[model samples]
Target: MSEHAKLPQDLDPDRPSGARIYDFFLGGSSNFTSDRMLARRVLAVAPDMRRNAVANRACLHRVVRMCLAAGVRQFLDIGCGIPTIGTPHEVAQRLDPSARVVYVDNEPVAVTHGELVLAGNPNAAIVRADLRDTEEVLTADATRRLLDFDRPVAVLMFAVLHHISDRDDPAGTLRSYLAALAPGSFLALTHLTADHAPEAMRAVTELLLDSQHPGTPRSKAYLESLLDGLELLEPGVVPIAEWRPEHGDADLATAAPLGYAAVARKP
Candidate 1:
């Protein structure tokens, strides 16, 4: 069957989505032709796009493990694209069967695929909503059913904030979400940046300007400012691959310049 046939009827297979594009970058089969086409364009200028995606994903795995080790059992993965291998729920549930996860995303394809992937799993559910809509997401039936704001929850936002424009107030959106969580909750974030390769990143940014999800790569200084209230964890806001790599994974070090990552506590 064709990729379009596999997608939900309500989705436009021709329209490129950032979630699908990132899924393609991670070598997943959930993306459409349009998503691959846009990804190829990005790869042409930013040859390290796929590597950076993998690095960012690895960072997420480390964060989940750290959170679980810290005694956190609930996870709110905002803008969690199509569920792929080693996803928060899968990683957490593997370590602790009772761990609850609520995946949130506004993309129809992502939500549809997430539902299918999470089927029969009572401990996990997918919520379709924009991350910027703090109240809506926090109050969503699935979110409330699976996560308890009175207890600590890990808010995962990997490779999603760049799509949030400045006018939308990314910092404020984060604050609002963090405000809903109880103290001691964690925020694990990984964002694209132009600090390492300005010209190449600028070219990629221009290519995506007209796409469905235009990206805005910020500098380390600016991304750091977003975590003002939260107490940033050790090795603050370093490259995605550099954040507590398991066994000192030397290969990921090269991709470090592509993005910044950090896990902070809502103290």
Candidate 2:
């Protein structure tokens, strides 16, 4: 494992973080040298990392749009990284002025950035919390202030699950969150998987595991099991690029590695 230096609340100039590495991949400047170094090393193994990030981000946008169409005005985005341009709150509020959103991230930098981005928006707030602790996440002051559990809520976990290693019991964590939602609520997720590109994807996973954010990628079967009790929407557990893509893909034969997106409803 890499020995990383600690970073302050405002900036972690020495240590590498998953959120910052992701930001670097997305061409954002919020990351430090350590993060960029790891990002580059992982990219050497998986050249499609950039494409994977973009496809998952697009899926996030599409899911949010679908939520708006479905008349969901309350959103709880867990494991949301440093807020960049066109975040969930920005998109949801544009769709409905009354829309409320709460962003949660374990990284202090992520929470700080989210707070700044959401400043002056009474309907939105940010909290620093771990996704593994579903109880605290759902019942936190920020969640209570911005979301009403009595009403339908759209919970988003886009491209964040892969970071939750197998030992963490990702399924159990998801179940706790799902159990807390009201009927008619929704669960939208985009996770990294190696089922499609085993060799290359595994190399990336191993690299990340040795880096600051330790994690493991799951197979399609494991991912499907995570949605056991919920009713999956159309195109269940497919490539993110294939999930209601604004522009349909002419070729759906080859599967995209390092990404899978799906949205389910709790009945």
Candidate 3:
């Protein structure tokens, strides 16, 4: 397991965090031993996890570019994990310096490292909050400062919703955020599913049940329901790897069974 030179005081190194485990799957060094341990267990059951992470991240990048191409300059990336290469802000700001982004994550390590990575970039900021709490996230100082609800904004929820349990009412939480967005705004999301490799994914989910972030991989129909009342984009909801893939992304098809992704406008 990789070790960071310094970690947040409030971070519990013994507890495995979903965000940190994702970072580990991305081959990033922002994870603790506990996180890596859990990730390894998951990989043993679902060897495609690393590839799935890559595909999910690629989907996020494409979503950002698509939103930018559609003239949406502001972004709210809720449940944004540890900041890494090809983040929404990096992609958006590179294309349009005026583009603004707000990243929200409940993990202390993610928030701390995000703050450090975003430090001098006036166009971007990170907020520490639970995504289920729409009000807190929407009203946070950083979110309000960087994003204007009156204008078109891209709300990103890549590899996030599955982490929210049914008890928290993930769909209701999503609706609250969607209701806040303007008509021209966009919602791009990716969620894990057990459609293709049910047994493997179910085992993975069981292992994560005791972690800091338990997950509930849903069905494609259920994920599609989350986009109700919005204008679904072309190609409709499909495997993450098939969502407007770019050159050299053909290999992503191998991981397509892992998750579902889609982008829609509020209309």
Candidate 4:
């Protein structure tokens, strides 16, 4: 058996992986039973987030399409999960065949799966690197080769930044990327927040601390602070479902928004 096959199947097939759990939530088959167990517990508290996951993905697609429409064709998807569907490349390339994408994820499984999925797509590539290490990720061979630093690129991080702990200075790490982007580049992100969620969501956050990864849900104000250097776009920092919802999507104004989503330009 392969080394990967020999491992036990937990949240990540061996441990709880945010990417794997996200994949499971997105209706992908790449997750393990442990991931489902945790997901069930979390979902039970805030049922909106399950729908939020779907919305978050759609939000990502819209963000990519928006960037494409704005004449920005290069992309950098940080903390990109195991590409199950509606990926940055998939969304961007579908609209403009010349679109280029560089997906970065610290998870091995996510990178491996991304590579396999993009095997024949010359305009796209994946890098196994931490998002916090902006220099390493942006300077990697694939990134240097596929993306042009001089052009306006869209950096996307959907439903992933909450996984970064405050101690690691998630805000500070973000500044590095913002500084690296060329003029008029964009930064789009969605982050989980306990402020507007059910009280029980806090317990779920604690539960994650004991898992293989540590994540802390921030407040709307805190999440907004992360955008200090960027200029907010229209309908700034609203709930995931409320961010330019596609036609036919249910009205999210009355629903309990599980996380916040927004896009900004580095002017």
Q: Say which candidate scores most in lDDT.
A: 3
Candidate 3: count of backbone clashes, pairs at least 3 residues apart or interchain: 0
- Pairs that clash in candidate 1: none
TM-scores for every predicted model: 0.96, 0.92, 0.97, 0.93
Task: List residue ranges in candidate 2 displaced over 4 A.
Answer: 1-7, 10-12, 248-255
Off by over 4 Å in 3: 1-4
Q: Give the Å error, residue 134, model 1.
A: 0.9
TM-score of 2: 0.92
| Cα lDDT of model 1 by residue, 48-123, tens digit | 8888899888889889999999999999999999889988999999999999999999888889989999999999
Query: What would the per-residue lDDT of candidate 4 be over residues 1-267, giving only the tens digit for each residue?
Result: 133453433224646678777777788877777777777776787666577788888888889999998899999999889897778898888788899999998876787788889998999999988887878998999999998889898999887788888888998888888877899899999988776665866877876775566678888898788898789998998888888888855554435677889999998
| Least well predicted 10-residue stretch by lDDT in candidate 3 | 1-10
**Overall lDDT per candidate, in order of appearance:** 0.89, 0.82, 0.90, 0.81
Residues 1-267, candidate 3: write the lDDT tens digits.
246567788888899999999999998988888898899999999998888899999989989999999999999999999988999899999999999999999999899988999999998999999898899999999988888899999999999999999999998998999999999999999989999999998899999986899999999899778888899997888888889899966687774388889998999
Q: Candidate 2: worst 10 consecutive residues by lDDT?
A: 1-10
Give candidate 4 misplaced runs (Cα > 4 Å): 1-12, 251-254
Q: Which ranking of candidates, highest TM-score first?
A: 3, 1, 4, 2
Instruction: TM-score for candidate 4, please give it.
Output: 0.93
Q: Please report, as a residue range, the 10-residue window in candidate 1 with the lowest summed lDDT.
A: 1-10
lDDT of 4 at 54: 82
Off by over 4 Å in 1: 4-6
TM-score: which is higher, 1 or 2?
A: 1
Q: What are the clashing pairs of model 3?
A: none
